[model samples]
Target: MEDDPDWGEMVSRHIGPHQKLRLHQVASVPEWAATADLSRYDLIFIDDSKTSELREQTIRHVLARVAPETVVVIHDFEIPPYQNAVPADFERIAFSSFRPMTGVVWRGARWTMPITQLAERIDARKHMSPLRHSAWRRYLASGTGPAR
Candidate 1:
C-alpha cells in the first residue's frame, strides 16, 4: 500500500517481521514507476484519496501495466468525497459502477457498493468463455471493443 511518509513507517511496524514492506516518499503519482509486473501479487488495492486528475492518471497507468487477471480493487468509491471526485474521463472508461444497498458509517458518512451491480458483474464473469476472457483483456488494453 502506497502512503504518505508519516503513515508508512507506522503501517510497516504494525505488519511485523513475517511481512515484507518498503517505503518510498513520492510527491505525486507521475513520479512513481509507470509499470509494475503484477505476476508477483494477487491483488492491487488503491485508496483514492488524491485529486481527481491524479487518481485518473494513476488508474490508467495501473490498467495499462498490470496483467489482465490482476484484481485491481479501489477504495473510497462510494464515499462522497471520492464519488464525484473521479473525473469524467475515468468514468467513461469504466464498464460499470456500483454502490452498496446497505451503508456503513465511515469518515462521518454512510458509504456502500450496490449489491445488484456487484452480483451482475460476478455472474457475468463467472459465465464468460475463454474467448470472452481474451476479448475483455484486449478491450482493457486498447480501451476499445473486445477482440474478434
Candidate 2:
C-alpha cells in the first residue's frame, strides 16, 4: 500500500511498465492495515518519513501482523522520530547509501549479520535537503537515537 498518490504515480511509472504491480493508495497506514491481509505479502515497504507518532504506531501495527519471513523495509531511515520507530526485537539492516536512507527489519528470523557488522555498513550521510539533514543530525545528537 502507498500513502501518497504522487509517490504511487512515480512508482507506477517506473515499475508499471516492466512489472505487474498491484498498487493500493490509502489515506494512511492504519487505513490499509484495516483491510489488508498481512500473510498475503512476502515483502512490505513503508515510507516512514512522517514525524507524527501516530504514523509510527501504525507502522508498529503493520509489523506486528506480518509473518516472520516477511521482509520489511523502511525508508527515510535516518529521520528522527521515524528512525526511532522500529520495534525492539527487529534487527536493522542499514545500507551503504544514506540519501533517502534505507534500512531493513526482520522480526521472524535471526539477522544474518552481527550488530557490529551492520553498524559498519550503515553510513550516515546527506539524504534530504541541507536544512532537514542539519535538523536530523541535531535530533540524533540529542541522544534519542534509533528506537531499538
Candidate 3:
C-alpha cells in the first residue's frame, strides 16, 4: 500500500506493466486498518519513507490489520527508528545488504517451497489495490483488481 499518488502512479506504470499489482492508496492509515481485508494479501509492502509524516502511525495500523500468515516487507527497515517500531513476533525472513529493505514473517508456517518461488506466486496473484480515499466509506469501497 502507498499513500502518495505520484509514487503510486509510478508504481502502477512500472510494476503494473511487468507484473499484476493492486495498488492501494489511503488518505489515512486508520481508514485502511479499519476497512482492508488483510487476509486477501499474501505479500504486503509498508513503505516507511522518511517524508511520510504518518510513518509511525501507518506502520502500526498495517501491523494491526495484517494477517498473521502474511509476509510484510517493510521498506527502510534498516533505519534505527523503524527497526525499533516493528513488533517482536515479526521474524526477519529476508534481508540483503545490497537492499536497504527487509521482509518479515508474521507467523510460523510449515512450508517446503523456496522463499523465492513463493514470492513469485504472490506477485503473480496480486489483486485489490485500493486508492486513498477522503472518507472511510470510500476507502472501504476502493481498490482495483489485477488486470485480466
Candidate 4:
C-alpha cells in the first residue's frame, strides 16, 4: 500500500487523529479492481495521471466495485489531459468548498499558484478571437492547416 516512501512520512507529519489513510499502487487498475474488496471503503481517491484511455478504463473498473453512495475523489481533474475525463454521473464540487493547501515543492522551496488565477485567465481569453480568426483565414486561403 505504501508505493511512495515519502507519502507515509508526509501524511504522518500533516494529518491528525481524525483521519484514516490508506495507500495502494497497482501497475494497472485492472489488477487493483480484480483483487480489492471495494465494499469496505466508503471513499476512494483516484489519481488521473494515466493516459485518457487508461483513466476512463480505471473509472469503469472502480465503478463496478464500489456502491452507489461511495464517494470518489479524482485528482488532476483540472489539468488539460484529464479536464474532460470526469464522468457525467459524478457531481462537480466547487473548489471554494474545499480549501486545499496545495503547492509545488521544488528544491525544498514551496511554490503556489492559486486555482482562481488560472480560472480567471481562462475566462479572459476570447474564443475564436483575432489569433484564431487570422489562422482560419490563412488556412482557408492556402489550405495549409488542413491535412491532405
Question: Best-fitting candidate, measured by TM-score?
Answer: 2
| TM-scores, one per candidate | 0.45, 0.63, 0.61, 0.43
> What RMSD, rounded to one decimal, does every model reach?
14.1, 9.7, 12.2, 16.8
The lowest-lDDT stretch of 10 consecutive residues in candidate 4 is 101-110
Candidate 4 at residue 130, lDDT?
A: 33
Off by over 4 Å in 3: 17-20, 29-31, 48-53, 111-148
Give the Cα lDDT of each candidate: 0.45, 0.64, 0.59, 0.46
Candidate 3, residues 68-133, lDDT tens digits: the string is 777777676666555665678665544433355565546565332455544443344434232322
Count of clashes, each model? 5, 1, 7, 0
Tens-place lDDT per residue, model 2, 71-109, is: 777776666665576778776676635566667777644
Using TM-score as the measure, name the better of candidate 2 and candidate 3. 2
lDDT of 3: 0.59
Flag clash pairs in model 2: 84-147
Candidate 2, poorest ten consecutive residues by summed lDDT:
121-130
Which pairs of residues have clashing backbones in candidate 1?
A: 99-113, 99-114, 100-112, 100-113, 100-114
Q: List the residue pairs that clash in candidate 4.
A: none
**How displaced is residue 99 in candidate 2, in Å?**
2.1
lDDT by residue for model 4 over 3-80, one digit each (tens)? 345664575567644446655444566456646787777666665333656665555566666655565555544443
Rank order by TM-score, top first?
2, 3, 1, 4
